[model samples]
Each structure stands twice: as C-alpha cells, then as structure tokens.
Target: MVILLNCAHHVTQRLQKTFVNYGEAMMYSLESCPSPWLRTHSMWGRYTVSFMLIVTQLGFCSVYFMFMADNLQQIVEEARTTSNTCQPRQILVLGPILDIRFYMLSILPFLVLMVLIQNLRVLSIFSTLASVTTLGSMALIFEYIIQGIPHPGNLPLVANWKTFLLFFGAAIFAFEGVGMVLPLKNQMKNPQKFSFVLYLGMSLVISLYICLGTLGYMKFGSDTRASITLNLPNCWLYQSVKLMYSVGIFFTYVLQFHVPAEIIIPFALSHVSESWALFVDLTVRTALVCLTCVLAVLIPRLDLVISLVGSVSSSALALIIPPLLEITTFYSEDISFVTIAKDVLISILGLLGCIFGTYQALYELTQHNFYSRVNFTGGIHV
Candidate 1:
C-alpha cells in the first residue's frame, strides 16, 4: 500500500505537470465512445472526471458545513451557557428544532457572504485572507504538536487493522486536492515556471502533511479530536486557533462553492424562462447550500464524514482517475502492454482501495445509527 500510494503520488504530480502543458481545454472532458471494458467504447473518460469533480466538491461543501456548524456550536454553547446570554430564535430544520446552537449562525451568514462577493477583485482579498490564515493556523498547529510531542501521551505506535482503514480514508482526504491543478496552471502568468512552482509548492505541502500527521498522531495519540485544532487545550489561545482556522476554511468555502455554482447556474439559467432566470439562480444556489447542510446534520461525525468522502471520492480523484486519463490521453499503438498493464494495475488497486475504504467508513457510521439524527458536535475525536 505504501508503495502504491508513493507511485500514485508521483504519477499524479507528474500528470498535473503534464496537464499544465495541455493548454486551455483539458482533453478528458466527456464523450460517449462505447466499449465493453476500455477504449473510446464507453463514456469512461468523461464520466470519471465529471463524477470526481461533482462528488468531491459535494463532499467539500458538506465538510465545510460540518466544520462550520460544529465549531460555531461549540463556541456558542460555551459562551451562551457560561454567560446566560444569546436568546436567539428557534429554527426547525428537518425535524430538529435547534436553539441558539444551530447552523444558521454559521451557514446563513456565510450564505449571505457568498451572495455578496461575486467580483474577483473583491473575492481576491478573502482568498489572500484564506491563504494567510491557513498558514498562520498551520504554524500554530506545529507549535502545539512540538510542545505536546515531548510529553508522550497515551498513543499507540501503530493502529489496529480496522482503525487503520479509517486512517487510510482520512489521510487521502487530507492530501487530496489535485483536481485544481490544471485550472490553476492554465491561469498562471508563467506557465513554464510552473514546474518549479509545483515542485516547491508540493514539497512544502508534503512536509507539512508529514509533520502534522506524524507529530499530531504521536502527540494526541488516542486522544486526538476530529481535527488537531480540537485537541488544543480549551484556552483563549487555542480557542483562537480554532476560530482562525475556521475563518480560513470559511473563506475557502466560498471559493469552493464558486466552481459548482458556475457549473450549475448557467445550465439552470439557460433552461428557465428569461424573466425567471435570476429567481432560479438564487433558488438553486440556496438549495445547493441547504443540501450540504442537510448532509452535515445527517452525519455529524466530522472525521467519519471526511473519511467516507475521502474513500468514496478522493480515492478516485487522486488515485484512479488520473491514471486512466493518462492511459486514454497519452496512449497509442506504440505504448507497450507492460506499461499499460502497470497503469491498469495502479487503477485497479485504487478502485479496490475506494471500495474497501468506503465500506469500512459506512460500517462505522452505521454502528451508531441506521439513519438517526445524532448530535453533530458530540462525536469523540479519532
């Protein structure tokens, strides 16, 4: 598995570099060439990429809602209970009548933010904020991990097999974001320099991932919360860390939503009556956000949600689909079956991983409820 992931990572990194060279329209867009297993016989090329984009983005939106709701609810309850303040109105959502502790404080405000910022000039400022806050929060996390690592908390040196599956899902979830590469590369001012930038950038990302994963797992061990931020001591300093990270994530949420909106809005606008286009756009956007909120409420465990989404979607996005894209996009009569077989084998392993990891996640989630509305903020950290 280690070897497989390493190969996949290198392949994905290299493919992304290749995608930079593919010019404006990525070649893997949908087609209906029918076939039994491979070739232009089926819509495999198109559907794989499309499915990854939609499913992964949906997972992202759900995660955003979950993160926002849980963190906001945590602070709100802490504040309201201690001070006996905040007499907010009740809003009933899907049989749950939430009091002051609800997603409206998180989701609704952000819904407004989404509607407000359409101009790139205005949005770029928040993007900068997102970058800065993400870095700042990461630095704080490293500090916390470094301080805690020496204490050697009651963490296992290795996980049991069952638990390790969850770790697989979560690890991929943390590292997965390769889908954005082509668009970013395509928009770059210096396309030739992108290789240097991609390498330097991904190296730093891997370093941070390694440091956080190793140190965080070591430091928190069995005590780690859904997020490392949650493992921080509940003081003003650490609480501020959660909030700062939330701010970064919150800003990025809009950016994430923008892609899906662009995909969905034009389609809706084209179909609806000219007079009703604006109304349809607003309605569709609201419904999309609401759908994510519903999913978050339905499955409150942030770690499980992340893992499940990772297993179900990120596995393909990061592992399976890219290799297939390479096979179809770059292959010809000259390409050896051995090389093709190697690529096919990597994809097969990715598929197996996706299926196994997804089953493992669903099994864990179902252990709690078949479909019960468990409190979103109540899950113990992994």
Candidate 2:
C-alpha cells in the first residue's frame, strides 16, 4: 500500500514538472500528433503497458517464491543429513560475489549495445525504471523479510552480510538511472532543470529504499531470506500482494531483457541484408533470452546474481564507462579540484566494490567444493 502510494506520488511529481516545463503544449502534442491513428489512440496504451508490467512483476514473484522455497528446503534437508539442525548457514557472505558476476555478465552486453544504438528516449525510460524499481523493491523486500525477527536493542546488528548484499546490489541498480541523466540533459527545455529532476529523483529513491529496508529488517531480522518475494508472509492478503509484486518484478526483468535486445539487434545487423539481418537479430535475441532464463532456473540464487551484477556489469557500465565517456566528451571544460575529487572517489569505490564482490564469490565456490569433497570422502569411509 505504501509502495503504491509512493509510486503514485513520484509519477505525479514528474508529470507536474513536465507540465511546468512544457505547459499544455506537450500534452497537446501527445494528443494531437500528425497521424490520425496516433492521435486517436486512447491513454489505453499507457494503461496497457502498466497492466502488462504488473503481470510481469507477478511472474517474477512466482518464480522467486518457488526458488526460495526450494533453496530453504534444500538447506534444511542437508542440515538434517549432516547434523539434524535446520538453522541457516552463514552462506550469504559468499553469495554476493556470485551475484556480482551474474549481473555483470547480464548487463555488460546490454549497456554496450545501448551506448552504440544511442536511442536517448528509450534509454532514459529504461534507466529510470530500472533504478527506481530496483530501489523501491529492495526496500519493500527488506521490510517483508525482517517482519518477525527479534532484536533486543537500538543498536542491534543493523545489517548482516545478506542484508548488506541486498542493499548494495540495489544501490548499484539505482545507478542505472545515471545512464538516463546524460541523454535527457540535452532534451529539457532548460538544461538547468536537469539537475533538479536528477537530484530529486535520486533523493526520493534513496529515501524509499532506506525506509523499506529499515522496516523490513526490523520485522524479519536474521531469519529473513530472499529479500524480495520470499521475505513476505504467506497469508491470503500477502499472497495477493505478492502476486502484484511478482507481476511487477516480471515486467521489470522483461523490460531489462528487451532493452538490450532492441539496442543490439540494429547494431549487430547493421552490415547485413535487411531481411536477413532482421531474421538473424530476432534469432540471436531469442537465444539470449532463452539462455538467461535457463541460467536463472539452474542457478536460482538471487543473492549470487545480484552480487555478480554489482561487481561486474554495474561496475563497468555505471562506474567505468560513464567517467570515461564524460572525460572524452567534456574534455574542453577546465578540470576543477572538486570535479577531479568526485571522479576519483567514484572510480575507487566502484573498483573496490567489484574486487570485494569477486573475491567473496570465488571464496564461496571453493568452500562449497571443499565441503562436497569432505562429504564424499566420509561416505567412502562409511
């Protein structure tokens, strides 16, 4: 309910800004475009898109629920076999590393393709949606996960590795919005207006995440797993809510999937025969989608994927590429101490995060393999 209200408020704010900047003229243009078909179309297109996005969220929620349940059950079963205990392991410390890698692999190609394609409007929309949704959802998920966990005092362990990974991944995802900033910077009627919108949007997103995360951790505490869908309770009301949340997640992923494909198709086929290129592009896009889906199913570890995304793709695209692009494009500007300091800070942070995440992932993998080996040897002894 709060999430819904916040979303409404955010949209309203954006629309109000647009109205102030462009006046009724922008609305008129949308309504009275040159083509009759375009002009006649109702706001149905927007509503339809919203509805589809909701459904997509539900799909992702369902997948998350299934995956989380299976993961928890697997852990329980393993514990029973090994020690007859159902308590969760401190496995999350390693989980972030895998997440960083997976996300990097998934996003790198897509980000590159977007840069090459240079469709500013679409990129702006995609970036905004990715960042805002990722941040908002993180808060909601964290709130849900920690709903029932007990904490004795004010300064209780505010964050665990799992929580940290979840929030960090979200923060990284939030930077996706930065991609939209540059493109839209030139499009605004007043370039100065850009800073207002950019800062306002980011501040709102960060606030929302903090609120949601704090509430969620307070509620679910240490036992909270799967920061998104699985964190929520299983009552009918929650189930219904979960359905909506799931649909939202599905739409988010679908959008993420489509953005890269759309950008890549044109570039990948730039040199080919038009007809043949279109066919090839479609084939490649479809294959990529299938492969990602397969990997999601096989891996089914959201934490690992999130960490991988932050460490690799997010690091490269969000941290490295932006600064490089800025340096090359804006080289004429005199370099102030402030500008140099900010750039240096951002680069160092991004690099450290990536390295830390990668190390964690490799360490976890080694641990898992070693445990498996020990078990095999014990079995032989038996």
Candidate 3:
C-alpha cells in the first residue's frame, strides 16, 4: 500500500512537470498529458476522470451522512432510559421519528445550508473548527481504545478471502486522498518542497492508520461495530466524543461536497441563462445534499458503504489511474522495460482489488437488502 502511494505521488509530480500550464486537478492531469491515446480522445479521458471524481466525492459525502447518523443514533439510544412503555417519539433522537433515515432527513437541511456556502475561504472556517474538535475527539477515542486491551493471540491475524477483499476496499477508501496530491502540491508556496511534505504527511497518516486499525481491532476484537465510535462505552465522555466527532464530520460534508459541486454545478449552470445561475447553483447544491442523504438512507451500513464506494470508484482513482497515466504519458520517452513491468504490476494489483472488492461489497449489500425486504414483508404479513 505504501509503495502504491509512492507510485501515485511520483506519477502526479511527473504529470505536473510534464504540463506546467494546466490546473492541479486530476481531470486536468489527464487532459493535458501527451499520451497518444489521450491526445486523440483527451475529452473522453477528461470526462472519465471527472465522472470518477464526482462518484468518489459523493460516495464520501454519503459515507459522512451515514457515519453521523450511526454515531448520533447510538449516542441517543444509549442516553435514553430503557422503558418498556417508551413511546416511539420518546425513542427518537432529534426529530419526531425513529430510525437512521429520520436522522438523515433531519440533518438534510443543515447539510444543504453548509454546502450552499460555495466559497472555499468561508468553508475553511468550518474546516478549522472541525479540525480542532476532531483532534479532541481522537484523543478521547485513543484513551478509550488503549484501556484494558485483550490478548491479540485470540484474534485471527488473517481473515478469509471475502473479508480480506472487504478490508482491501476499506483500506483503499482510507487512502483515497491520492487525488488531492496535485492540487496540494500546486497550492504549496514552495512547490519544490512538496515531495518532502507528501512523504512526511503520508508517513504520519499511514502510521496513524496502522495504529488505530490494529489497536481498535485488538481492543474490541470480533465485537467491533462498523465505526469505533459505536463500540465506545455508554459513558458521558465517550458519548460526548461521538457528538464532537459528529460535529467535525458534519462540517466536513461541505469540503467533500465541494468537489462534485465545482464540477457538476458549473456545467449544469452553463446550460442556463446568467439570471438563473445563483438559483440553479443553490438548487443543485440542495439537490446533491438530498441525493447523498437519500443514498445514506437506502444503504445505511456505514462499513459496507465505505467498502463499496472504495472498491467501485476509490480503487480506480487511487490505484488504477495513476500507473496507467504514468505509462501512457511517458510512452514516447525512453522508459525502461522494468518501469513498464512495474507499472503493469501495480495496475494489475489495483484491478484485482477493484474487481474482487466490488463484487464482495455488492454481494453483501444485496444480501442486506434481501433480508431487509424479507423482514419487511414478514412484518406486513403479521
């Protein structure tokens, strides 16, 4: 995985160096490359990259929605008293309803409002606040995780093939930020120092991912929920951690939503008159937020959603695209056979992960949907 990330960074830098005038977006990298295939079908490449990016960003937004709902629901359910005669409304978290869907619906308007603020500078204020709260929340979570961890020998080091594929999807999802590489480098005041920043930052990120994942699994073992937050004890501090994390994720929705909006909304508004631009933008933003909410409601399994998203799109963006881009862009150069072999190997690994991971995730999702329908039908019959 680390090797793959390094490869991605290398390709991204090479792309930027190859095309100095283009913007720092993934689509621009694809469009501006000197590949013969892309030169002939540059527009197609651009649109493909754009579509993948849109899917990846919106998948993130949907995951955020489900994540917040799951954590918030757990917090509320834990906080409420266990009464045999408790009314459905009494069991409700925020709105006058029960279940995760209601929570998603209740949060929809707020999310719409947040994404409506299209200015990156304005959104950064929210991002700053979210960062602070997120740090605090992580501290609390780490405190929770490190306490009384059980023996690691009891747990299986390697899961079965299906679970392994799921893990691959989830892991890919975690590192999907590879798409941001060029943009971050382009924005850096000292672009020359970006390699240092990239390596340092990625090392820290990978370390944290390893620590949290291994520790969380060792701590909770088989009983771990989709999120570590849900596995938190039903105590005030931990509950507050859930809420704090929820707030951070809530604020983060805008930044994730920003990418797709920048792509789709403008293109959509282009078809309309100048007078309708603002209205169309706001409407489109609201509609997109609602779309994510709807997706969250439909497939409320946070873990599976993450895996599915990662496998379906994140794998392509993070794994498949970079090496292929490198190979294509540098085809005319005197590149070594070993370099081509390495690129092909990396691309193959990504393709296998994508195919297997996607299949497993979709299979689980269908099983979930099937059982849900059966239960619903049974309840109706009763």
The candidate that wins on TM-score is 3
Please give, for residues 1-382, the per-residue lDDT of candidate 2 as tens digits: 1212222233335456432111121222334334466446634433332333222322233233333333333333333233433233333321222332243244424433433333455644654665555556455455444545557465355455643543454356444433223335545667556556766876886786666655555554444454434444433333433444443443344444443444346567986887797567756665555455455444455444444445544564456433433332223345466765666677777777767765664454344532111111000000
Q: Give the higher-TM-score candidate: 1 or 3.
A: 3
Give residue 69's lDDT in candidate 1 (0 to 100). 68
Q: Estimate each model's TM-score.
A: 0.78, 0.55, 0.84
Ten residues in sequence with the least summed lDDT for candidate 1: 21-30
lDDT of 1 by residue, 1-382 (tens): 2222223334345456443211111232112112334534344444445556667776887887777666565554454233323222122223334532266335665664474465544665787998899899788778767772645555445667777677767777864445455444445567457567777877888888777877876765555567666565545555666788888888877766665565567778999799998788888888877777777767777778888888888888777765655455445425578867977997898788788889988998888863453333212232
> How do the candidates rank by TM-score, highest first?
3, 1, 2
| Candidate 1 stretches greater than 4 Å from native | 1-44, 80-101, 115-122, 148-154, 336-338, 369-382
List pairs with backbone clashes in candidate 1.
Answer: 33-41, 33-42, 34-41, 35-41, 35-42
| Candidate RMSDs in order | 7.0, 14.7, 6.5
The CA-based lDDT of model 2 is what?
Answer: 0.43
What range of 10 consecutive residues in model 2 has the weakest lDDT sum?
373-382
The candidate that achieves the highest lDDT relative to the unseen native structure = 3
